[model samples]
Target: MRNINLVLMLLCTTLPVALSLIDGLVPNGDFEEGPKPSQMNGSEVVDPHSIPHWELSGFVEYIKSGQTQGDMILPVPKGHFALRLGNEASIKTKLQVAKGQFYSLSFGIARTCAQQERLNLSITPDIEGKGWGMLPMQTMYSTEGWDSFSWGFFAANNEVELVFYHPQAEEDEACGPIIDVVALKSLSLPKTTTDLLKNGNFEEGPYIFPDTNWGTLVPSNIENDHSPLMGWMVESLKAVRYIDSDHFVVPEGKRAVELVAGRESVIAQIVKTVPGKTYDLEFYVGDAKNLCEGSMLIEVFASNSTFYVPYESKAQGGSKLVLLRFKAANDRTRIRFLSSYYHRKSDFSGSLCGPVVDDVKLVSSILHA
Candidate 1:
């Protein structure tokens, strides 16, 4: 009875802390809390630690909703405040994370002045030297003027500092990207099942902001090892949008990935296979039903088989299943998927859209025999 009571007490205290890490945003991540008047020199933050719960350096500006730079009004993705990182500017916050665990950092970003802007993100105490990533802002996928992006990292220590830095030294100090709603979510290592591929259901991924309709974009060339979308490598020059069924049509389950950049957006995985063994790779190709209308084509590459699946999206939610049977020629086989054409919403939102790939499964042919 004493041991059981002690165990109950421990669970009662630790359970909330674990749940809070998964559900709650980082302290003032949305930047809804503003700095005092003394911290301001016009729009530029005068004090490095003026902002609550955040440390800043270089030319960081505290921006409010409806604030204008010239004739352009800066839009905040959520809440009334956002932070702008100017030339070589950066904002950082410390997090208490479980050591050796994987976490995904999701944040909203919008370009203000520079057309070729990009954000440098890193988590320090990086033992493996793979804790940093660069996300390009050259393309705007949503017409909402801002998009949320996610990057995954392995925690090297119990406490880590998450930093977002703008590396550009533009002529205008204020010319940079606006950021808001920074969130961190713990990711479980996807388990391999009867399916040859891990995370084949596209169920595990970065956190999605509930208030925003646009899904999180996983940056290009993300490796399978540290990808925000677990077990899949984004192997193209352009990022792939991770959509949720809450805001967009998902072919199956609650989540899926949209290949929005045509051939430029690709997701792939490598699976161990027995030589001369036959396997069947299956997936669903569909539209997100977010006003994306057209003939969408998805190309699937597996071992020694290549297949093209065409989907005619009438802007209504629907999906078609595709299968590719192949014989494994090596001990390992590479499986990849890419859209053959790019598309935008028919609503003239200029928002990039494409076929969603989900419910992917790969199994040995003998399993069906």
Candidate 2:
């Protein structure tokens, strides 16, 4: 009788304490979490200390357990740390709490390609591209060391694949470096979670241009990742439908826009944009053919008059990525793609043409409420 009484007293004493502990772990005030492990990524990644507690899911290849350089590392100084990769691939993870909200994303990343390869990264549209956007990888991660590449975008959907790509492949000495991690961080800012999406919007594209075919084209059918197979051209279109078999590419010397013309089709919504805010933009222009010249123009702040913004040099010569940032108004802002821009001053004619967009990000540190 005494023993039974003691057991009952102990249970009664610990119940309230246990409940209090669980209450602290519930997300959004939902169900609580039980006990958790002390740490995650026990041995798979490098400098295990850099990575905190995360449940990682990855597609690893050519990974040797004993190799540290070929694994995922963590928390590079805001913008200081950099490493070199040698024929490897991997991605770290974070439990996305704001699963359906759009976030302003920025990170410094690059790869060392001995020849014509590039670094790559990819992601699945969880909730249909809902919370983030990225550019197709093409920057040459030269054999000399590494390069810096970045992009920005609004998440168009959910349940999507997330991937990374590394440039250069052919002349890789023994093995080409996949990519070196710089930093992956989400800036802190206020954004409308509800106002960003419309009718389950999506980034449905892989619109391969038949103009240049150095390799097989992988459409959205491939997992949302930077697969090696996507070596050729890749494009992303919001709220779109793609057909790979009949995809069109502009022919050499016969220049024309692969315009998905019509207002509703070409324009992308500026989700959660405040009336007065500044943002940066970038896209590519390049030789998609042997002797063809192509480029693009971005239309912004146009009050019915198609605004013409052209690509300027920062990297590759004529057709390359151009970046511009400006204050945006609270009202609806229109964005469009213009095929050609004519210089009336000298009668100079040039058009922006490139396989894919690199960075279309909007970011600001000082924001007004």
Candidate 3:
């Protein structure tokens, strides 16, 4: 019995390590294994030798967990340690990747000293059509707290060098940006008939709602380039509300999208599709507010065809999935969802109430020659 129990403990410890190896391709990404906290110095620059699985250059500082330097508090975005990139400092690692395959690189970055700091990220062996090359310099300014950022890139060679460097700082001080929780994951290409749209579940976007009263009162509309709903274009004269699982009934993941706060609110995405192929567009439509009277109507437009679907809130408490068939007239198709029905007088809530949408997908229909 004692031996069996020991085996169970070993399995529990080994399972996480095995799963992490499969999920996280980057080694020591969380910076858990590093030099002791006493070795870190605030005034002097440190080398990357103390950190495992990374190569460093220029002036870099290793920040231990719970360590504070002067008025600045060094916080780890993940794990027990993080690296602070001084001006003109960089850290890089070589990764094995398949040529012509796509991958996503994500990391947590925070601004400690300056409001404006920029980092240059690059992948070696530039590929023309695959989009694997030096990424555009990104500027991060998060004085309030740490923020997570991600980018998608294609592998140009079997071995690619992943680099993160802070080229310049706002002032002459050695301080720059703090980085942690680095991760790289390979992405599988969708099949010919699979959906191509990203963030279809409304799960990846601005997480926090602007107004705390969203539980009792609806918030205003959101319409901008970097709107809360990532990978989507929201167009409306009035504001649209971004809903989460805590406040509303999500049809899919922890979050869903609503078309409210405006008379004519629309969310659209342009996707690449095989020309001259028929495709089926599937999505879920429901009522976000129980106070909504009558019925909620939504119009789906794919390519040139349009379909209207309505949902009665009293009949059903949640959402229903609906599918529409359309043909891809060109290589690119504009798929859009528009709120066509709105009755402000019937709704006891003073704000505009409309239909909610979630889990949108578009895939090619099998063709018989």
lDDT of 1: 0.87
**RMSD to the native, candidate 3?**
10.4
What is candidate 2's lDDT per residue for 19-58, written digit by digit as tens? Answer: 4222111121110111123432332233323333222223
Among the numbered candidates, top lDDT falls to 1
Worst 10 residues of 1 by lDDT: 15-24
Q: Mind giving the per-residue lDDT tens digits that candidate 1 earns over 1-369?
A: 999999999998666446536744788999988889888999899899988889999999989999998899998989999999999999998887777878888889999887889888888865565778787888998888899988888878778988999999999988899999999898898886898899988899999999668999998754323788999999998889999999998989999999999999999999999998889888888888899888888888877778888889998888988877889899999999999998999988899989999999999996547
Ten-residue region with minimum lDDT total, candidate 2: 23-32
Off by over 4 Å in 1: 1-20, 127-129, 222-225
Error of 2 at 152 (Å): 6.9
User: Please, what is the whole-model Cα lDDT of each candidate in the order they appear?
Assistant: 0.87, 0.31, 0.63
TM-score of each: 0.93, 0.32, 0.56
Clashing pairs in 3: 221-239, 221-240, 222-240
TM-score for predicted model 3 compared with the true structure: 0.56
Q: Write the per-residue lDDT of candidate 3 for residues 273-341, one digit (tens) a residue.
A: 777789888899876554555677888888879898988765233789998988888999998887776
What's the distance in Å from true for residue 146, model 3?
1.1
lDDT score of model 2?
0.31
Compare the candidates by TM-score and give the number of the best one. Answer: 1
Between candidates 2 and 3, the TM-score winner: 3
